[model samples]
Target: MKISMTVNGKPVSAEVEARTLLVTFIRENLRLTGTHVGCDTSQCGACTIHLNGRAVKSCNILAMQAEGADIVTIEGLAKADGTLHPMQEAFREHHGLQCGFCTPGMVMSAVDLVKNHPNPSEETIRAELDGNLCRCTGYHNIVKAVKAASAKM
Candidate 1:
């Protein structure tokens, strides 16, 4: 199947198998390896990405399903000048990640969370993050980072 989509602010097209997951298309086809596939079963949100301005688990959808959709991987979250997104900076400033494996999806999810809730409380942040799992940091700093980023965002 030939899939065409806007990725990381660039229009791209590639030939992919029907069974190819969106995560594979992003990581293997597009070479945007920042979107991790921590759990192929979709239990983990490591493959989360923005699908048309909304966050979705890339691993849960087929590459063809994303046809012509606007996609944004973690690599595209920053500005062209190389400035980190406010959420990324908050993750760094608050030490939100430890192993870094789940940081990308976590950051993406947080960005969506804040978009829906500009002033999310700690409990709201925790609840909204139910889909994303992080083995490290115990979510203490992660929650803090989300709150911090919400203020800046």
Candidate 2:
């Protein structure tokens, strides 16, 4: 199958197998390994990415489903000049990640949440992020990072 999409800000086109997962296409075909695949069953949000500005678990979607969509991964969150996004800076400042496996998804989800609710309360942040699991930070710092990012936004 031939897939065409805008990834990270660059237009990309590739012929892929019908069975190829979106995560596999991103990491293998496009060489964007920042989107991790912790669980292929979609239980883990490690493979999250932005599809048309909304966060989705790439592991659950086939590459063909993403054809012609606008996709954004962790690698695309930074400014073209290399400066980190406010969320990325907040995560770093607040120590939101430990093992770093869940950071990409967490950041992606955080970006979406903040976009919708720029001043989200702690409880709202927690409830919104219930789907994305972080085994390392105990979620305390992750919440702080979201709050911090929200303030910046």
Candidate 3:
């Protein structure tokens, strides 16, 4: 199938198999590997990406389903001059990430969470982060980062 979509503010079109996962399309075809594929089953939110202004696990979505969608991977969050998003900055400042394997997805999820709840409490942050799992950190800093970003965003 030939699918066209806006990815990272650019128009992108490619031929993909019907069974090709959105994560594979983004990582392999589009060469945006920041959206990790930690688990192909979608249990982990490591493949999270914004599809048409909402976050979804790319591993659980088909490339064709995103045909006309506006996609934003972790790479798209930064400004053209490379200014990190507030959430990204908060993650760095709060040390939300440890090994960095889950940082991209965690950051993506945090962006959506803060967008939805601009004034989230620690409990709200924890509830919103239910999908994303970070084995390295116990989520102390991640929660703090989200709380900080909620104030900024």
Candidate 4:
């Protein structure tokens, strides 16, 4: 199948198998490696990306499902001048990551979370992050980062 989409502000098209995952297309065809493929079964939110402005796990969907969609990977969160997004900067300032393997997904999810709940409470942040798992950093700083970024975003 042939899939076309706007990824990270660029229009992209490629021939992909029906079974090709969106994460695979982003990381392989487009060479955007920030969207990690951890737990391909979708148990981990490591492959999360913005599909049409909403964060979704890329590993959970076929590439064709994103045809003509607007997608944003972790690499797209930064400005063209190399300035980090507010959420990303908050994560770094708060030390929200340890292994950094799950940072991209966490940031993506946090961005969506703040979008829906501009003034989310601690409980809301925790509840919203139920899908994402981190083996390190018990989520203290992650929550803090989300809260801090909310003010700026």
Question: lDDT tens string, model 3, 38-142?
Answer: 978887799999999998999999999998999999999999999999999999999888898888999999899888888988998898899998878659999
Could you list the CA RMSD of all candidates, in the order they appear?
Answer: 0.8, 0.9, 0.7, 0.8
Q: Sorted by lDDT, highest first, which candidate order results? A: 4, 1, 2, 3
lDDT of 1 by residue, 71-104 (tens): 9999999999999999999999999999999999
- Please give the range of 10 consecutive residues that has the lowest summed lDDT in model 4: 129-138
The regions of model 4 sitting more than 4 angstroms off are none
User: How many backbone collisions does model 1 have?
Assistant: 0
lDDT of 2 by residue, 46-119 (tens): 89899999999999999999989999999999999999999999999999989898999999989999999879
lDDT of each: 0.93, 0.93, 0.92, 0.94
Which pairs of residues collide in candidate 3? none
lDDT of 4: 0.94
lDDT of 2: 0.93
Between 3 and 4, whose lDDT is larger?
A: 4
| Model 3 quality (TM-score) | 0.98
Candidate 1: minimum summed lDDT over ten consecutive residues — where? Answer: 130-139
lDDT over C-alpha atoms for residue 17 of model 1: 94
Per-prediction backbone clash count: 0, 0, 0, 0
